[model samples]
Target: MSHTQTIPTRSSINPADTWDLTPLYRDLDAFEAEFSDAESQVNDLSSYRGKISLSPETLLSYLKAKDKQFLIIDRLYSYAFQTSDEDTANTQTQAMKNKTLSLYNRFFASIAWESPEILTLTPEILSDWYTKEPELTNYRHYLEDTLRQKAHTLSPREEEILSLSADMSYGPQTVFNMFNNADLRFPSIDDGNGNTVEVTHGRFISLMENPNRQVRKDAFEALYHTYDSYKNTLAAMYSSNVKKELFYTKARSYTSTMEAHLDCSNIPTKVYAQLIDTVHAFLPSMYRYVALRKKLLGVDELHMYDVYTPIIRYDSPYIPFDTAKEMVLEGLAPLGEDYLSLLKEGFDNRWIDIYENKGKRSGAYSTCVYGHHPYVLLNYQGNLDNVFTLAHEMGHSLHSCYTNRHQTYINSNYNIFVAEIASTCNEYILISHLLKKAETREEKAYLLNHLMDQFKGTLFRQTMFAEFEKITHEKEAKGEPLTCDTLCSIYSDLNKTYFGPDMIIDEEISMEWARIPHFYTPFYVYQYATGLSAAIAFGSRILSGEPSALDDYKKFLSGGCSMDCMDLLKSCGVDMTTSGPTSEALKVFDRYLTELESLF
Candidate 1:
């Protein structure tokens, strides 16, 4: 992600760039027409109000019409937000984004009445509708889930009030983003010679991965020292967010806020709790990995920056975007020809915005709406990492494609718990493919190192984050003040335990939590660990051509939001409700560790 600052702004990027939104809509006028149609439909929602209970047919018509209306709103909001994230400085796009957020809020608020309205339906009537209409019966699961959230359901008016309170509710993410993105500045690192290089968030990880020991150490210290200066402010922002969760949880009649949050996705509280328990139980393995890192890196003591610096030899090679596209096709062939063909279509059809351009997004991700091909944003700079990133994002895109194609509009959107699976599966499949292509021992070891880094970051590091979040939330619930010292003490201790004793826990490591954007989003880290675990298990079986594994993997991608995540994975031969999937995946990690040692 380190850009050569010497080149001209947009001209520096590759000319073979793939992103052009013209295919989506001819121009602003076409999008405006769609926007107008959606607004008009929102205005027309009043017509179906009283007639909702008139008959099963009437109610179905209202819901169908409502779905279409909401889909339009979702598509508009999605496009705007995706665009905005790519470049925060574009004034026109920012205005469009703000308008889009406001409209989307209004759109959600407009429909807030429907849930409570539907909640009013007596069991007798709901049952009658189900029996009278088969399509209504198809939504039995949806209705039941809604009713399960009955206590959480505020009156329409209160829901509207809460919807309006979004800005205030978003104080944590907003404040943290500002501090992390705009306000905080790292100490300029002496990049050899007399010149100093400014450290940026996008470049932080890449710099940490630098082979130069001094560079890694300087970058790690400089970055955290910047965060340390604002630790108190960051702690306050985090406290506010935790309290927000507590308030919402208590406001809803759930036993705990964690349960309240997870219940919507039909995720059991045990899944979250089990991820913690399992990771905690396996602390020794993490410690052993740390010891190995210390030995392999040959550092007197490894610091936070040394952690990201590649321990094994890295054959850092450039992979062109076109070659990456073809590689993804071969890598993902296990998904079946139908899936591979769509993958090809997505590649050839300009579904991806390739190459780093001025004002383009910093990181990579896949986003698109129902009835549209999945869209990816990338600043692909012809690096091997970028190629793997392509595969990863495509996993998400293809997952979205399958779900959107198969499900009703209401069910088209899937949960984040399952979201990482498709993406990570693509990563695993890609690594397996690339490992075959490696012609040297160094190349093979480099891939293993990347694989371990992925596991350690997503699985182990996220578990650490999950622990930090759990500590803060519990402390907040007990009316404990989240002071800088208290927060840092808790976080730093976790760094020691998770990173194991061998890595030198520099003082700056304590400030690491302040920079994590995910901390604003509560109880969210556990999903990354669990999702990757499930993904590896599923992908491993499928790659080995296990009986029914491919079919099961397709079943999972096709589940959309219809089934709970655990049950969805159960169909894919991984029952994540138990800790078995994670432990099994960790066994694979252990095998990789063995491979890593063999390289030495």
Candidate 2:
């Protein structure tokens, strides 16, 4: 007997496999009604703009009303985006998402006088108001954060002008997005089997992973050379982005772009520097891993294109969705009974949209509304990677679940700096469980390879990108031109440093920086490195049955933005402000590399 599988339409999908969004809204009519009411409430916030500092009661009332309005808006936005993601081709949902976004924009614009007006009053006055109106105590932290920006806060008119420039400031990123996604093109490459395959942004990584060296080389060269053809134009776009960062940095009275970006989350500059220094200390381990790749491939010279190809080949059995769930549950048992119970609840309830369907989004994500259980969207294919992805995204959902249950709406959202920790920590725990259960050498080796790759890609690779950003921005700040040559040279040198002496730094890799979308976002890539490091540190302690490790980690998960991200991490005993967590993470990488080397 033979069977064929097909992607189902949204309406045709099994109800069990789809998320129960009725928890958010029962029908379109209900959503529309709530949305209309929320819009009215949001618009009414403008009346409280200048009256924010009127009196204690008025201030408290405005704050409460604002939070109430936003909570409704959050639910409406969540429902619209989740629905749109279910079937991107559906015009109705798309329109709904756009409408919600417009209202969201208006909501922020309506409250534009919030910070400046709040800053007009001194901290002592607010503290007095807090005592006078006990209810104002609830927003103590929120008010403190606003006051923290008093030094950087401009006059209302100046602030309004800056806000007006928001759309104009996004010009560089918009141009790059259009050019990279729409206009940029690459030539077709011959597949190892004499088939021609077009190199696309989506397909480039898969091509680089092709077992045939010639195919990998072809894809790498084709993609980079096409980028190289427009190197000057790309350089200008990146330079413009850097200039914009500088403009805002100076405008906000921040000493540098990194300072301005990190200030938002109260992160110290030392944390960024510490990550680079710690990663540099462990470059030898990365070189050893690179050497192992070269030995496993039995190639005299390993090129940049060769780095992504798997050193070991194993064809594991197809994983059914049920099996994936079982695997995740078994793998995450180290997190204890309460965690497992919640995981099972999410599974039993329709909290997850579990499979691919026609017109659905291609990747995976976890989103939450304040009062509802978090929802995870997965385009689950029956594979080991998909299983890991399931574990990863559930980590995010459960994190939000814990936070929403514990924190108020105002503090429920965590910063992006610590966002990936839960997800990556879940990944580490799952991989550890799988490693313990593997009965065959090849299986163990394969699992070990996957674990090592996470270290390489997340910790090492992202830190390198972070360092590149640091150097380029510093040069631009010093009035040095970031021409195509200068950018390529800096990138090429960093690649050689990170990949070590075993790997050949191909000329094509020099143009690699032009293709990175993250660089346009300033100093954001460092968090991927720091998040993984913190996750590994926490994972180690929890798995070893360290006392209070599990409880402390749960506290961190429930923290949300209730505290500074660094303080929250520190309370969990993984202080990212120092190099200890990153160093320990590197040590684990070294241990794994040793074990994998011994297996070979």
Best by TM-score: 1
**lDDT leader:** 2
In candidate 1, what are the lDDT values of residues 129-239, reduced to their tens digit? 888887986566677678777878988788767777665677787666645643565677766444567666656676787788888888888888777777778888888
Please state the error at residue 536 of candidate 2 in Å. Answer: 1.6
Candidate 2, position 81, lDDT: 86
lDDT of 2: 0.87
lDDT tens digits by residue: candidate 2, 1-600:
323334478899899999999999999999999998887776687777788888989888898998888888888989998998787767798689878877776677667778899998888999899889998887888888999989998887777677657756868976785577546768988878766767765456667767799999999999999999999999999999999999999888889899899999888899899899999999999999999999999999999999877788776777999999999999999998989998999999988898877667656789988888999998876777678889989999999988988888888898889988999999999999999998999889989988888898899999999999999988988999999999999999999999999999999999999988888899999998999999998999999999999999999999999888988888889888888889989999999999999998
Candidate 1 weakest lDDT stretch, 10 residues: 1-10
